[model samples]
Target: MIKKPLFPYNPKYPSVADLKRRAKWRIPKFAFDYLQGGCNEELNLERNESDFDNIYLKPHYLKTGGEIDMSVELFGRTYSAPFGISPIGLQGLMWPNAPEILAKAAAKHDIPYTLSTVSTSSIERIAEVSDGKAWFQLYHPTEDRLRDDILNRLKSVSCPVLVVLIDVPSFGLRYREIKSGLSMPPKMNIENIFQAMICPEWGIKTLQHGIPSFATLKPYMEKGLDLSQLGQFMNKTFTGKVNMEKVKAIRDLWPGPLVLKGVASEEDMEGAISLGVDGVIISNHGGRQIDAGESSLISLIKLANNPKYTGKVKIMMDGGIRSGVDLGRAHAVGSEFNFMGRPFMYGVGALGDEGADHTINMFKAQLYQVMQQLTLEKVSDFPTRLIR
Candidate 1:
């Protein structure tokens, strides 16, 4: 018989913040820091969430309302909601089998889940779990053969959308990661081992799932490579910067919808349009890169309002969005869709396999509440409710 989850969605832990608090205690400090830390002073990280408060919505209490329709249509598909799971790397490090867990949840809920190229689960594994509904995020590889191989693997799985990440031209200077000695094969010092011992649940689950590695890239990696070699391999494998030639190459190769992620400027937006990209996710790499950059919300408002980009490409934003209210704020500001990474990880970290389902349910419930309050009847109506 299948076992049930230890804790269901409790009213006491309704918010993502609550899940985060529980996750911090349940996982090792090093792992938690990897999931939560930002680069440099983390100004951009803090600003992403704080800037959402500046947006105000005007409720239409006097207007007539019926049941709210939360479904959204994008790229010839209708998702149950307007939000999706953003790509996150090393997800299994945060919680054992997190990528698979989130993929299953997204498939069950009829929402999109973008799998990171560096995530622990392989493309084939996630494709099976998501029933071919998962999207793939490509980190431009240094070798043409490697890039072509990964894209072909995605195609064999019948992946719907391909999201190319462009922001990480270089790794962020995350101090927490530096201090914790976090690496591909996590540096298991005495302190890290002790921390794991204290978090017995995470430790046991990790053992069951096997030690998290770059599963997606394992086929190409040398067998039984040491930690130092693995680090060197990663550094040599991926070229973080994405130029026009690379974008054009990918556009020419991939037949499905192509989305350009990490777009925070008009130049990048214009480039994506020129390259004939399908969508653009206005993100600041969750403030993990470039501490002095503007928040994703700030970038979204500017891009969404400009007529030049309004109909040119499908606009989505992701960074520091904690709840459905924040989703409403994004929609009000002309964002066609939204995505979140840390929130779903917090859920899985807090409640094991069941966390993904709980987190998605929470988002739906909270979004419905916001719609009722705004006297809105459909997800598309949110833009008109803005108090601009």
Candidate 2:
């Protein structure tokens, strides 16, 4: 007998691509561009998705399985799935209350939800929504005092893991944002206003939520700063590259699992292992950081195949993953864990409150179908099916 999907999702938008297509029309073009565009020429963005085509998994037709168990353990806790939501800054800008929507859905689904420091939701708010199981991704503040304060806040809420971003030494040059006036110190032009007017649903939601601001950082910011002033404040607050010293400092301060994100090379992987980090997320800031850099999957293959770093630390990856099939592909290539950013946002953008749940369920269903086809009983068994 065939098994039914564990979670119910909208059949109308069954895949991430469907959600993306619907989202393009539901939200303003500026918002859609921000959610979709990568840095510079977007070559890296194209490569991030296109590179997955190179990965192929072998299917076994004769073998039988007891059951496909999707649950995986990380940082002393078992999550419902091997994948989690990646941290996306300004989440509310794309869809009002996006972070909260994702957090609640993650809690209900029993998967990890990572909240960005610059996201439009407060740490406490996300913690409340996710039952304090959410992971916090810090952007590495320039001031030690601010860093300590943020750490203390995380401690108070019992945040499970702390992910420090190391890839963005400087913000990448995104041409779309520059052209749309979403560059640092954003502007509200006539075109932008007209775009918003045409998207009545988005405009209504924006009115209900008020203007999207950095909810987590509002305490540190002065009252009533305009767009340009807000940009200047952000630049001044987080104006340095995250170095070894900074990671070491964060490692010493936080007692829980500490992960360094934006790792693209073996050299950086070596550095992370030396610092005694709990894990390292192989990422290129989802192809938003350096346009000329290698695709994240290529970087993952290099680190995963290296003998020296094997089993030294937990190696995870995130980039170009749009479906359960892509998640399986990443696993086959040695990604111990996986995360996705834009797909979830697209779900919320296209479906509103139900979007996160639909996206999560869709991924779960797709992965289950793939595993059943391969007679694969576990997610870790994917590497054995890798066409290496």
Model 1 spans > 4 angstroms off: 1-8, 183-185
Instruction: Score every model by TM-score.
Output: 0.97, 0.98
- The segments of candidate 2 whose C-alpha lies over 4 angstroms from its true place after superposition are 1-4
Tens-digit lDDT track for model 2 on 211-285? 898999998999989888999999999989999999999999999999999998878999999999999999998
* Residue range 73-178, candidate 1, lDDT tens digits: 8999999999999999999988999999999999999999999999999999999999999999999999989999999999999999999999999999998888
Weakest ten-residue segment in model 1 by summed lDDT = 3-12
| Alpha carbon lDDT at 246, candidate 2 | 92
Question: Which candidate leads in lDDT?
Answer: 2
